[model samples]
Target: MPSSASAPSRARSARPGYRAVLRAPHAGRTFGAALLGRLSYGVVPLALLLAVRDATGSYSAAGAAMALFGLASVLLSPVRAALVDRHGPRRALPPMAVLYSALLLAVAAATARPGTAPAALAALVVAAGACTPPLGPVMRTLWRRLLPDPDLLRRAYSLDGVAEELLFVSGPLLVGLLLPLVGPAGAVVAGAALLLTGALLLVASPLAAPHPRGGDREERQAGADGAAGGGRGRRAGRLGGGRALRSAVLAAAVTGLALGALDLMVVAFAEQQGRPEAVGWVLAALSVGSAVGGLGLGALDRPLPNAVRLPLFTAGLGVALAAAGLAPNLLLLGAAVALAGLFVSPALTTSYLVADEAVAPDARTRAGAWVNTAVNAGSATGGATVGLLVGHLPLPLCFALAAAPALAAVPALRTRDFGGARSRRKSDPAPDPAP
Candidate 1:
């Protein structure tokens, strides 16, 4: 790591050339990849909802299929990351992309047939879940490798977070618009096509090239040596000895649950007022707020210490979300949603950064995958539990309940302070100044 003293000098020296490089065609490819990835995410949820609803003629079944997909993705995330680490992204990305596209086509085909619909939809969900190339993770790893400056890297990740929020807002809207013209099956196919095109561009971009450090190669060779020597148990033990990986996985799970609850709360609150459309507006307000926060954070030259910032922001977010449930008017609820959203992108960005700093360089991709998987898993869990509660209880009660996960996260904020030398030094404090 560069010293604090040299950081500004390095930034001044690199800024002009970095800007020029970022303006090149390859950078456009990076943006394209990001755009497509977000678009695919946006399209998939709506398309799945529509296709499953059309095929099985049940909203519950559709939701179940979506949940299963999330579960499968969570389970497969590590495996996908392992592949990216072992073979390099170039070799790993294409097959996953192809499989993802093919699965969508299969789903489209299944929707056309009445008798075979259920099994096919289930199969498609599983395949889609398994085959989702660790695009977000891979892309993030590439960005880190390509941009060496810590601040620049933070900015990139923050921008990506913003882009992700934009995608969430716009993707579904796009699907809604396209549904009339192309039908649900066609929208699904379009999403697949986008995924394929985006994945290819991402893999081909200059930033996406493999950058295995000397230590990474050594670790790989050692693993191979151990395997060839029939030291399977040793190899397994070494791989499983990743404390950072465990931390990332836990964080992901927490994030997933929190997002899921947030989703349920929004819908439940909207329905409670007999103005279901308010749900969309509230969610949109949240998304817009998150996007604004991310962009503003990214543009900043200085950032608050993650240790201090994360807990404060997250706790504030929890309080805001809780307030939204208690809000009696639409205007107040909208404000609450916006307040809750203000911390979202920042919180997620901090998590990603922490995960990045925690893991070994080569393992970063996998670590990121773990985070994404956890997010999906959490969202699914939140959706199911909150959905069920809303069905049986008062909507505000369900909304209030949704804040539990975020509230639960307050204690975990200390986890962010770990492995930091400054934190350690502060705690140790020179034997309390010799008493």
Candidate 2:
């Protein structure tokens, strides 16, 4: 077998494509299982929301419970990711999956019948959210291992992002399917089952196996360097210490803010046009545009360096959103939103790529998780901010305001290094793995 140091060279020489990534040994099984488990992230929220509403008989109570759940999940993600980095996925993932699954099952049982106490339900959901496994970050980190070639890794990230977008879309549909047969609580049960089964199968994949001691020369050297005291000060200190990661996190947060605000703004636009029902189609257009953009990015053989691409994507989103605000009619608004969507996945995928390249292998999970948290936190903040602004400001102005963060992020993201010393320059023939 080739050594870890030589793997990137071999991968670089191979043709890069979505198919090639899938064909990488163990990639298909690992990715498939991760997606299966990740689907629960999509499924559980709607299921739990419905169940909570049914149990409490008050939308306000249900919304409050979900808010606590989402806050706990988003805020504590890095902690969970740190644990994975500390213990290794094989050792850590299963327990989290088990606990998270059990909690969801408990939530289902409690919500199966009406009159469940809101406080008790809130506690259960909060615990469940805190236990939500960091599968997305783990899977992305594994992708780096599975595909050492930077091009392939880029495609993998794009594919992963697109798959995730589709998963969230399909999740609600899946719940809808189950509702006729099983109802809301049963949908929650089904989500729990999916999470447990997928997580177990993910760990069972060969790719999830720990790297043998001494197999990774770079990590070994990094470990040695860290142990040597003063050397640690010179290395990227922590998740946020590096410039590249900061840029990624900033871009991610801004883009997320734009998206979160856009969601509410779109609904408001539809309502203003006397076509509230058009909201779904407009949002679906955004998703479809994102999927297309992601697939287009994955198909590239020699795409622009992440540093160069990141700013452009963010700017594109900002300009598109600004245009969306000017649309005179609902159809035009949908078109403009779809245009904005085109940048969503590419920007996020590039951010992940930049973050992965910014840190050492040991810190990969935490690095990715930080970016994940920034996006979610920014989204939550944006929604709340826009909710207040929409009632007071013109809807068009609100849309333009939503575009501000993404536009502002462009300059910050324009820096030369998106992966610290590992990032490829614009003139480089292709990206190479860090030495």
Candidate 3:
């Protein structure tokens, strides 16, 4: 912890950068450990897909297993986050990590030999998915505990978002490296090991210690209510009490949907140009643009309030997506996609900020998880929607259609309920003494 004398000087610094975010006591260790664990999320999907396919010898079976795994993980995210919120990370995370790791090892074992039953793989994958630790949400909550200044928190979240994006990108590469040595089954084992180590390190961080103001107070209150006649009112009020949370979730969902559609749209565009292999390069541009945009957001000392910024960023992404459809060539499409990417990270970072601030401390993890759920669910829906429409509709029209949800979300986000000044007043507590 900083000396009392140093706190004032720290506060007076104009704009906290990513460097400052890292410099927070225990911040770097805590965040790095979280990232290490999150890398498993990046690695496991492709690794599992390949492992299953190799074992089952059927693309359809592999697809089904992957779908089951993803669906279970995405759908249960909020439940896992709620566990962390109610029980605290130290109590909640380890058991989840252990269970998930064990399941992954089971998967690896099953895939070690050929002709593993598709039914067995699907069941194992679903169980593993359901047990997947909510490390991302928990880490974001830790950031809140570590950095109370909204500016520093903004920087922290932006950094987190960008790092996560890179992790997902690099995860596949790591599997590629491991493939010759370990094969896909071995890659699955590596993911499990990474997850277990990261989760253990993360929980051990001093920064991840249970907040005095978080779960305990809520649990006590709930017990008191149970003792009296007021039953489950707190549960009812859990994630639905505020307009800011709702808008943040809605915007995140739409933005995710648009981006998901863009992925397929880009492929379609590349194929139409008779250069299918160019898809990776175009997507790389998108990732780079998002990284730059996220860093730019973190650099801002003073920025528009989340209420205004969320809608603005979302709309910018929508407009860019719509414009991308008009590009007749791959170069132009890539450029447009990059432009759209500029809004992606900023929008997501702001949505997380909104979600964090909109809820009570104990509820923050679940709030953030809701945003995560929205994004994943939206992305899935968008990809499926575009898949159905791609051959049936003109490519340009499909692009415009992909952009529509984000455009429509803008006005809903701008309502008085998400009023910038009012929401900030409600959400921004005085900087909690740096833990």
**Number of the top lDDT candidate:** 3
lDDT against true structure, model 3: 0.87
Better of 1 and 2 by lDDT: 2
Query: Candidate 1 residues 124-235, lDDT tens each?
Result: 8888987877777887777766664567777777877888778877888889898999888888898888889898888887666654575347544444443334323334
lDDT of 2 by residue, 142-249 (tens): 998888778788899999999999999999999999998998999999999999888999999988887777434445346334423323343432443367889889
Return the number of clashes found in candidate 1: 3
Off by over 4 Å in 2: 1-14, 214-241, 420-435
lDDT of 2 at 100: 96
**Candidate 1 vs 3: which has more lDDT:** 3
RMSD of each: 7.1, 5.9, 5.2
Error of 1 at 16 (Å): 8.9
Off by over 4 Å in 3: 1-14, 212-215, 218-237, 417-435
User: Number of backbone collisions per candidate, in order?
Assistant: 3, 0, 0
What TM-score, computed on C-alpha atoms, does each candidate reach?
A: 0.83, 0.91, 0.91
